[model samples]
Target: MKTTTTMLGLLLGLSAPALAQGLETYAEFPKDTPPGNIAIAPDGRMFMSVHEFYGHALRIVEVKPDGSTTPYPTDAWAHAPQEDGDGLNGVLGLQVDREGILWMLDGQGENQTGRIVGWDTNTETLHAIHYIGQPAARPTSFLNDLAVDREHGAIYISDTGDGANSAIIVVDLDTGRARRVLEGSQFTVPEDTPMIIDGREVKLGGNPAKIGINPITVDPTNTWVYFAPMTANSMYRVRTTDLLDTDLSDADLANRVERYGDKVTSDGSTVDTAGNVYITAMTDNAIGVTKADGTYEVLYQSDEDLPWPDGFAMGVDGFVYATINELHRSPVLNGGEDASLGTYRIVRFPALSATVSGR
Candidate 1:
């Protein structure tokens, strides 16, 4: 609800159609830190991960209505020692379920283990902790994003592995067991594509970044899980039933995968009840959608290059909120020198139809 005078001035300058489409700045961060992913509670509370790529101190914070941020849950939990088994290691994905549980995905860096922590917001207590280690999470695994399937009692994670060994990790919430699937498969691996941003190729460690299987989301019905590689041109999906079927062979599971639609190089995505997948089209500096008919369209294109739209969260207010962190300019992606301009943003627009909050 806090709209700065500068943002209001920018809004006044937008074209009529852009305003009519409902795209507008929601909040802005004037600091050097960058936010990675966002999760909205049914009561309108906003939480975001301070991107690990930037090596910031705070891991996650709750963005207040006045555009200020405070350490989420508690300062102790946010800054707890990872080795002490009481804090978040590296979190980039989180969501709130129908029961008011905020599930956070912690990809333990260096340790190479991953775990999902569920916090009960309604009671302000710890709900559950499910560790994903060993064969389920490879040494090179970079657990990026996740989709919660409440109907199936599971959580699906995209392991953007060392590019070549990328896979989808399915975790059984009931038993805390995990299985890595689709390793080295075309659907999970990135294509030989270069991410061209601002007329230059984005690179990491002096090489073109080939990130794989970054965006993952489940439909409103929780029937299908849609995901795609960060550098791929197409989206792919599989039924939640098939993903939870442990009896199915790898080949059978691979055969079950289907091409969803065409998507530009993107980061975060969310689905509406009408079966539309809203994408953060980072390559185009725009927000687009893959409709029910499998056709894609640009819904909102910002006049100023949207730094890097990173994550999506469907709010109870009927708007789809996203974080714009300018990640491509991070020191890790750039040549060890941060090129990001301050005043990062969290933007929102009206959803095409009803969407599930905390998605």
Candidate 2:
């Protein structure tokens, strides 16, 4: 890992003035394709999933320091299947664990089933593949984001299932068993609030985007998993121990959920060692923090509308990197017209406290 001062100066070209201002542009991308989730490896390598909504040909890419991208792992794995063998299918949530294993959430697997792909960056080999289908996943299940709890040998996923049947799917890495918990519970369901951006209601398919349980993350110690619906005002959390317990019934697990703090409509989140939850406050065009005390504060606001601060990744360099893709302006949400300005960005700023690379 590079020192923070050297990284800010050499890699990002961030001046002292810019550092004080917050949210410096670290990288940029074209509007035709948008990045969904971001994951930074301990070695300072960055990876991102092409936002599934855009239907880009590339599912995942390794972003270089020069702002160029290459099909990650291999060209064959980054694109749709041509002949045979495995490839990433609609990957949204991805994180590089402490062991250098990149876990990708393939929400749209073959036949629209869901799966988790773990690739060991250290050995350059496939680590494991766990299929999350049937009773563990619903017909409308959109397995959006995931949190890798290395401490508990489990993976927690947020299945935003058509808003009505949203739930959390826990995958035991040791056994490759996935169990759906808290289905349709208040903790997983979205509130009635409408997502308003730029003073206009953001809608999808001519209806308010009532997305449920979008951003999911684990703390530095991997003790608690914090999450919230994309349209909700409050963030919720649960102990990893309870989530990994196979004996806990749906009702019993629901009782363990606790409201962590108040948050604005957000897309992604990551926690630090100090317990501050960094949120992509999309509605506010800023990055906000929910302190350990359960109080919220805006940490960095963009000069212009920041569009949608889609995902977050704490780099080894001590800065939190985020993707700024204008998702609300996409044709899917803009009534069949592309309203984007044709430029997207990845920005970074110093974290409030020391943090891990991937959350």
lDDT of 2 at 307: 77
lDDT of each: 0.83, 0.83
| Model 2 lDDT on a 0 to 1 scale | 0.83
* Local distance difference test, candidate 1: 0.83
In candidate 1, list every pair of residues with a backbone clash: none
What digit string (tens of lDDT, one per residue) describes model 1 on residues 106-223? Answer: 8867744688989888898999999889789888888899998888889999999899999999999898989999998999999998998877799977889888999999987888
Candidate 2 residue spans exceeding 4 A from truth: 1-20, 303-305, 357-359
TM-score per candidate, chains pooled: 0.92, 0.91
What clash pairs does model 2 have? none
